[model samples]
Structure formats: C-alpha cells, structure tokens
Target chain A: MQPYNYPSKYLENAVEEFAKLPGIGRRTALRLVLHLLNKPKEEVEQFSATLNEMVQNIHFCSICHNISDNDICSICSSTSRDKTTICVVETIKDVMSIENTMQYKGLYHVLGGVINPMEGVGPADLNIESLVNRLKSNDINEVIMALSATTEGDTTNFYIYKKIKDYNIVVTTLARGVAFGNELEYTDEITLGRALLNRVKFNNSFSVE
Target chain B: MQPYNYPSKYLENAVEEFAKLPGIGRRTALRLVLHLLNKPKEEVEQFSATLNEMVQNIHFCSICHNISDNDICSICSSTSRDKTTICVVETIKDVMSIENTMQYKGLYHVLGGVINPMEGVGPADLNIESLVNRLKSNDINEVIMALSATTEGDTTNFYIYKKIKDYNIVVTTLARGVAFGNELEYTDEITLGRALLNRVKFNNSFSVE
Candidate 1:
C-alpha cells in the first residue's frame, strides 16, 4: 500500500495514540481522526481540551484510593455515608459498580491492585496497610471484601484477611455474585448481585454461609 | 437515579464532559471515565498530552484545506501525488478511505461539510471560493466529486458545478458506490470501490458526460 499522506503528522500521531485505546483498531482510529478533522475548529478544540482537563484535574482520593479531584473523595467526605464499615474493592471501577446498585452506603477502600504473584504483585504492593490502619484507628465494624471471585481475588482476600485479623473488625466478603475465574470488571450486574447476596463468612477459608 | 456517589465531583464532571462526545451516552461516558481511572498514571498522562498536542499542533493545509501541521498537507506536498487532479470530498474521512485503497493518486480538497439545508449549511458557508481559486491558478485538470450519494451531497455538488462551469475543467463524481441516503462515513470499502469505478461526468442542467 502507498504511504498515507495525512494532513498533519501530528494528526496522524494523535491517531496512533488513540489506536492504542482499548477496542480501537488502526482503521477506526484513522476514521476518528478524519472525523475530528472535519469538525469545526471550536469542536476539535473542546474535544482535546476535555481530554487534557480530565488528566490534569482528576486524581485519586488519598483516603479511599478512589478517583477524585481533591485529597479526600466525595464519598469519604460525605457525612451521611456509613463510616464504620468499609467495602474493600480491587479497583475503582468496582466501586462504581457497587455504587450503581444503590445497595451499599458504607465507605470504600480501593486496593488499587490485587495480589497476583504471577504478575509480580505481592501483598506489600496493594493498599492493604492503609486498610489495616483504618481498622485500627476507626470504629470500623465490618470489612466487606467485594473483590472478584477469581483465584487471584481469593488469594488477595485471604492475604488482606490475615493482615487485618488482629483488629477486632467483623470481616465479610461479597456473596458470590461473580462466577469463578471472572474478573470484577466484566461481571454483569445480575451475577454480581447474586454473589453479593450469597456472600458467606470468611472463616480463614472460603465457604458458603 | 440516586445521585451517583462518584469518588469525586470532578470525576463526575469529567464523566459529564465525556458524555458530550458525539455518539457516547451517559453510561458509555461513565464507562470510559472508569476505564481511564484504571489506567496507570503515566498512560493517563500520555492520553491527556496526546489530545493537547493534537489540538495545538494540527492545522489545515492552506492549499487543499486538508488537516495538517504545516502550510501544506502531506498529500498536497508530496511530489509523487497527482497535483493536477483534486478529489473533492464531503469530509476528510472520505479522503482517508480513498487513500487507503491506493487506487487514487490525486491530492484532496476537504469541503469541511456537505450542503445540508436541514442543518442550515449552504454554499456561502463552504470553502467553494478557495476551490474556484485553486482551479484558476493551479495546473489542475480534473475535479472528482467523491461526495456521498445523498440529497444533501447532490445539492452541494450542483452548487459547486454552477460555480466552476466557467473554469473549463473536467468535473466527475464518484459513480454512486454508496446507496441513497447512506452517509459516506458508513459505506464499506467494497461498495465505495464499486462506486468509485462507476463514477460519471456531472453537469448543472444537462446529463452530458
């Protein structure tokens, strides 16, 4: 094929960058770039500015490790939310998923990552220490481990449980709304619902209540 | 829905901003925001930078009106490309589609938009004057109208034909590779090919080839 004669090398460069986005292929990326080119100057400017603003403005809430524009996330700062109970999640997406159900009003503590030795991630790499610290100082009554039901998730859950056992907090996990081997990100609302409903006690080993 | 306890109001604000994308709805925008949140900090930073760079660096080629970072677009600047023939397209995406096939060797002239009365776009608003000027000065021989086969596209074509009739240049349009009312943006490669091959000569008041 002949080399492409893009209007701007930078436009082409941007297309290449967009191509790296999940689910975007080369042709689609090119199409998107061309579409952007056809747009009025102000529209393209807004599109670019929005992306830039998102990155420059948004940040992780230091307390819950959830996304925020400030030091303390909205949920953590809200006086109405139950502060004594913290729902543990592997990622911020999981927090959104749980929030979507409108079932949980407790606080959240994002692990940022799970314990996956295969990926070179260990216990020390996660936000486990912060969670333990929260349990130690606060009147936290329960810790709901709402991680995915994958082997990696189970390992991470167990690891966190061990670290937090010394604290007299009631530790529970989301009932099995997730199917085996599925990541929390991909699990549908129904399955996640079932898993949450079926959550059994974490008695050093995983078993249905 | 209950007020989404998004980690941050800024995150919610960003999600609202993304929701304004052409085809994205609130849910999809939210999904995209969560996806970006999950990305590594460096990747997110790079994504933000890419948008800024694209907006700040990209420009339209003065000659062909194609998007570019320089005074001339790549196609317009290249020595190998046929500068004598200009392919008139409704949008820049049409240019890429034609370029990808490696069949057309001519430079491009992005109209920026098609004539659509419903949308309040008309001839006076288009870059028709520059096109007429290009024909007057350049060694341009043939002007191929590769606009979509929609009523709006036809309206733009006829309007352009009237303006350029006095220039004594060959005027041709994409032989109907697209179906009636189907946007050029949606036409697949094969159909576009068939249409390109079947293009015919166009005139304002006569069907003369």
Candidate 2:
C-alpha cells in the first residue's frame, strides 16, 4: 500500500515532525500525533515545553564533555568520585551506562565518538586534546578505556594509548569476556579465549560476602 | 545496572515525557532528547509549535468523525466519492490505510474503537450513533466493516449488524484469509478454512491482461 496522504495539513505537519525522531516511522509518528490529539491541552503543552526547554538550555560538561545543565556535570563536580582515575568513553550514553553499573566511581572523559575512518571521524575530531591537557595539568594515575567491543573502539584506544603513554600514567582497557549469565557454549571463541587468558580469581569475582 | 540519574531537571523531565509515548523506552527517550539538544533552536521550536498548533486547532469531521482541520474533512465533503457506500472503520488510521490502497472511492464512518469489554469500551463509547444517524439521513446502500481481525472487531460488527439489520442496508465484513506472499502450509486453520469456504471465481481473482 502507498502512504496515506493526511487530509489535514495540521495533522500532516505534526506527523512529519514526529517522524524526524530516530527509529520512529511515519505510521508510528501518525499514531503518536493522534495520541497527542486525544490528550488534554495542558499535558500536550507540558510535553512540548519540556522538550523545548531541554534543547534550549542543556549544555555539555566542560571537564568531561558529558551532557549537563551547567559548565560541569554532577559526576565531574562530585567530591566522592575518584578524580585521579578517569574512565575514557565514547559518548554521554556510555557514561550513563557505566554510572548505571555503579562499578566505576571514577571521573569520565567523553570522546563524543570513536575514530572511524569510514565516517571521517579521527583523533583530531575527538576530545583527545582536552584529555591530554587534563593529563598534563592534573595528577591522574590511571586512564581506563571503557569503549565498545569493536574495531573503532580498539583504534581509538590505541590512538589514545600512544598519546598518553609518555605521560607515565597507567592505561588499561575493560576486561573482554563472556557476559554474566551467558552460556559458555554460545559465547564466541575470541571472548572465551580472552576470558580464559585473563581469568580473575574466584574470590575476587563476587562482592556478596 | 541501575539507571543514571540525569543532572538537569529539564533534561530528566523531557526524557520522562518522551518515554510516555507508546513503545518508547527510557534509553530511546534519552536518545531522542539528546538528538533534540543537538538540533538548531529554530527546528526544535518548530517541532513543538507544530504539535501545539495541531492539538489546539485540529477538529474532527462532524459527519464521519475523521480527524480534520475543520468541521468537515476533505473526504466527507468531496463530491466525487460514492456517499451511498460507507466503509465503517475502527479509527482514522483505518481510513488512511484504505485510502492508501486507492481501491475504494466510497465515504467512511469512523467508529473510533471496537466494542472492547475488557477495556470498558462499549457501543455507547464509540461514534456508532452518528453512523446510524448518517445512514438514516443519507441514501446509503452499503456499509462495509473494515475492522481489525480480532474478537473485538467481530463483536463490534455483530453489534452493529443487529442495530441496522432491519434498515434495508447491505452490511458486509472484510474478507479473511491468508495474506499475499504467505505460504499455504503456514496459514492458520480458521483463515485457511474461511479462504477455502468463501473461494472466489477464478476469473475475478486475476487482474493480469
């Protein structure tokens, strides 16, 4: 079937706007617009107002390059976090993911994106300079690379490794292995090999006690 | 992993609002909010303004209950459409789907929803009365039920059938069978039985010259 041409220009415009969002198709956009039409005027107003306020006021953390309402993000400014150990990640989402784990209490350095030659993203395009500057000025002891398990992530890690190797800071990568609760038979060979090679002590694997 | 608590109230509020939409998770909502943050101020303004304008000003067609910018929708007002044949659908989305097919040139009667007892929706809750009124006022000869293939749809069709049976109107339901490109072996029993029982003339099935 061909696409339905909406009769009302207002409905069409609303659907078009909704469709601009990531992963939202025209059919889904129409459903969302119609749902808004059924809601109270005040609620619709609140939804739009909240989005507008976010877009207009939201800023990035000056220190970590993470999303924030001010110059410095809460994580960056927090006194409890281990500022000497900075976990370098690709995007703000990565920062949120690591924060969710509650396993990493260190500060973050968002690179915005990984170095992908195909996408024209290079070390120069990332926040590498700021990271180097942070290393040069601050008393950082460790730099943990918590990037994705991909070629781009590896490339970015290597690039950053070469840059900070001369600064006398310990550089490390996230441990590669089968995820918790994953079946050993279903796990890929590379991950299984790595997990075996860098096997942690059984007592150190759990904090339940 | 626990969720990362957003620093900005505005950002959190926006993400929460986006998450309110059907099928959108908190992660997807955050992505959408971040995408808006990256967009230019004017584009975001336009997105909100369009939704606001639609919710504030959009109206439904008085005759058919279809979404419209005015009292009468284009389909309802169109002189070329066969007003005598009214296609009864559950929602505006159905109308759009039928229109997209470009096979039916008849008018439409939007019932808004089926008689879903589980959800507390009944005949009184839908726009059924208006449809009956339209039949009474107009020279409508046929009323085609274009509802979803569900028990609720069947219940609604039966209910409406009882209401207008004595009015000398020809009431019909959509054909049920295996869909195009579907393998006969995989077709369900009820649909396959219906297809076999209501087999059409061989000559009428093909449009190939």
Index of the highest-lDDT prediction: 2
Per-candidate Cα lDDT values, in order, are 0.79, 0.89
Against the native complex, each candidate's DockQ, computed on alpha carbons, is 0.34, 0.70
TM per candidate, chain B: 0.82, 0.97
> What tens digits encode model 1's per-residue C-alpha lDDT throughout B13-47?
76776666555667667777777766776776676
lDDT of 1 at B132: 89
* Candidate 2 chain B, run of 10 with poorest lDDT: B200-209
Model 1 alpha-carbon miss at residue B182, Å = 17
Quote each prediction's TM-score. Answer: 0.74, 0.93
**Model 2 spans > 4 angstroms off:** A201-209, B206-209
Best by DockQ: 2
